[model samples]
Target chain A: TQLLEQSPQFLSIQEGENLTVYCNSSSVFSSLQWYRQEPGEGPVLLVTVVTGGEVKKLKRLTFQFGDARKDSSLHITAAQPGDTGLYLCAGDSYGNKLVFGAGTILRVKS
Target chain B: SQTIHQWPATLVQPVGSPLSLECTVEGTSNPNLYWYRQAAGRGLQLLFYSVGIGQISSEVPQNLSASRPQDRQFILSSKKLLLSDSGFYLCAWSPPRKLQETQYFGPGTRLLVL
Candidate 1:
């Protein structure tokens, strides 16, 4: 099974602060996705990156796929209280199945 | 305009009890359905997926099993439940014909096994 490792399992920051989360893997993937999950709810897709070195922006959130397609990162600028949630990164591997990282819980304090 | 529904938003059951959770998707056809389990502080684990009626693929061997009885209906069940089964159960769907398509999730069901 493909494994995706996420860094900084937990993060707390004051509002307006910036934060970044990283997802790394040893195996290459066809595509990668980022999701945000609020309490008691299933994760919602934030973005999907298909090409190596691809970058996509969703408002204040910026996502980057590594040049090797083996890693990805998410950066939030001027974080707000609404930005708090559990962030997850998933990789699409053989059979079009997604392998997910453990997840990073982020809290943006007001 | 697609929506996925999972019933019994929260369930509390004693150990060894039979388990049945249902998921149905509306507003689409031939969509890919998936079942996932999320333990505390863990990521979503793919348990099963189906591309069509009566076609199911098991991703991990465990106390849980999944079935697709209709075009857009998926079910997760177990003859007997275990305490370790307590977690958040999620059902997701993606558009057909692509493995890398984006997936939309349901509201989710919280299961607690005592």
Candidate 2:
């Protein structure tokens, strides 16, 4: 079975602070996606990285796919109170199913 | 534009009660549907996926079962509920053969078993 391990299960930071969350795995994936989920809602797709060493940016967030396609990272620059939520990373394996990491709960205090 | 919907936005049930949750996708056909569960502060746990009508795949071995009766409708059910079944259930859809493999999610259903 493939497993995606995420680091820093919980994070609490002041507004304007930057943080980085990492997702690592031993198995390779065809694609990796980042999602942000608010309270009482399903996850919302942030970005998808398909190529090794690919980097995508959305507003104040940046996502990176590792060179081996076995890992990914999400970085938030100057996080605000609006960034408080659960951040999840999912990888599409050979069976066309997404294997997800445990996720990181980020709390940005204003 | 495409949208996914899951009914009974919130549910509270007894431990031995039967379970039924509905999911439907609109504005798309031949799309892939998925069911996932998320415990408090945890990531998504893929329960089932379907590529077409009457086609279902289970990823975990548990009391939970899933079915796709129609092209755009998926259901998750269980004969009896367990305390562990309390969590947020999410339904998602992805366009078939999309290179990015991005999934759009519904508002989700929150299940609480007592």
Candidate 3:
């Protein structure tokens, strides 16, 4: 089974604080995706990384895929209260399946 | 533009009752459909996925089953409800025939079994 291990399962920070969540795996994947989920709602896709060592940014969020294709990270700069949510990392296994991590719950207090 | 819908939005059922959750996609054809379960604001647990109609892949087998009756419709059913089955059920879709791509999720159904 392909597993993506995510760290800092729970995080709490004040507004304007920075945080980084990591997703690691022993198995290589073709692509990695980041998602943010709110309470009582399905997760919303945030970003997808297809290239090794690739870096993509979306406003205050930065996503990076490891060169080995076995890891990824999501960094949030100057986090606000709206940024508080569950951050999930999913890896596209081989063909049609995706392996998901446990996810990181972030709480940014104002 | 693509949209996915799942209903009923929330459910409350007694144990041993039958369960059926429906998911449908619009503005997209021949899309890949997936069913996932989340434990109260936690990570997702993939239950099943379908590449096409009548083709379902089971990831974690138990009492749950899935079916794709049309290109854009997917259903999750169980003969008997379990207390452990209560959670946030999510449905997602992605473009077909892609090696790797992003998936769009629906609003989700919250199920609670007594």
- Candidate 2, residues B23-95: lDDT per residue as tens digits? 9999999898899998885898889988889988888899899999999999999999999999999999988
Question: What is the alpha-carbon lDDT for the whole of candidate 3?
Answer: 0.93
DockQ of each: 0.68, 0.59, 0.73
DockQ, candidate no. 2: 0.59
Model 3 bad stretches (over 4 Å): none
Candidate 2: interface RMSD equals 2.5
TM-score of chain A of each: 0.97, 0.98, 0.98
- Per-residue lDDT value at B5 in model 1: 97
The 10-residue segment of model 1 chain B with minimum total lDDT is: B94-103
DockQ, cand. 3: 0.73
lDDT of 1 by residue, A1-110 (tens): 68999988999999999999999999999899999999999899999999999999999999999999999999999999999999999998755688899999999999
lDDT of 3 by residue, A1-110 (tens): 88999999999999999999999999999899999999988899999999999999999999999999999999999999999999999999777578889999999999
For candidate 2, the TM-score of chain A alone relative to the native chain A? 0.98
Model number with the top TM-score: 3
DockQ leader: 3
